[model samples]
Target: MTIGIEYLRVVRERFAVLKGQGDKTFAQLDEEHFHWTMNDESNSIAILIQHISGNMVSRWTDFLTADGEKPDRNRDGEFKMKRMSKAELLDCWEHGWRVFLNALESLNEHDLVKTVHIRGQAHSVIDAIERQMAHYAAHIGQIMFIGKQIKGEEWANLSIPKGGSDAYLQRMLKEK
Candidate 1:
């Protein structure tokens, strides 16, 4: 495959991995736990979801034709604490991901070299994609950290457990 095709495939795989981590974290949390916060200034999982979803929608819709930051986006409002049911939160999450993944799927090799705008700043399509990938990954990390903090000892391991590296390696070898 060409480099552009390979890059796109790799980017999609990385995004899928990030989303899987988020899904696992969400599964381990109760509705109430989604609102848990470290302090008044800190964001809860719900707030993070709101912010991430809002960002995804704004940045991905008309990704190449229009500026990434939509005119109607309430970037500041996303950080405000709002009480939403777990179902509502998940719906919001799904909507954002749908828009984002669709946009990513629609790109072609030629489009990679095209320019896009975010907040009036110019970026090549590849650079724009990398920017969003980094942004989403950072937020996902925050979600995972918050989930782990609330679940504490009850949190299911997302990757190898503290001392399971040898066993995990052995299992992989066996599979091979």
Candidate 2:
């Protein structure tokens, strides 16, 4: 594979990491906890998921031919409180990832340098992907944090169990 393809492949794997974290987080909560916020001004886990999915759809749909910000996207409305069941929330999340990850898979080295616009500002395809990746990761972090706060002692470790990093590293080294 060419260098660009290798980078794109790594990008694809990063999205998978997000999916895994999100799935595990979702599994730890019920619909009742999805909408809890620390304050009136703060966003809840549901809002974060909605915003991330909204961003993914806006940036990925028809990504190459048009501006990354779709005219129909209600970016601000993503933060509004909605009575979303866990199923509805998951549907939105999966839809966005499906579009975004599919776009990543379809890219070639030649596409990496091609210009794309986000809200009219131009970015190379690579830059655009990097931007979205960071945005998504930030939201996922919020989701996990909130999950931890709400679930408290019941929250499952998304990575190494609090003190298991040494064991994890040793196991990895042994496997390698």
lDDT of each: 0.94, 0.91
TM-score of each: 0.97, 0.97
Report residue 21 deviation for candidate 2 (angstroms). Answer: 0.5
lDDT of 1 by residue, 67-162 (tens): 999999999999999999888998898899999999999999899999999999999999999998999999999999999999999999899999
Q: In order, what is each prediction's RMSD in angstroms?
A: 0.9, 0.9
Task: State the weakest 10-residue window (summed lDDT) of model 1.
Answer: 85-94
Deviating ranges (above 4 Å) for candidate 1: none
Identify the candidate with maximal lDDT.
1
Model 2 misplacement above 4 A: none
Q: Candidate 2, residue 32: CA error in Å?
A: 0.9
- lDDT by residue (tens digit), candidate 2, 97-142: 8988888888988999999999999999999989988888888988
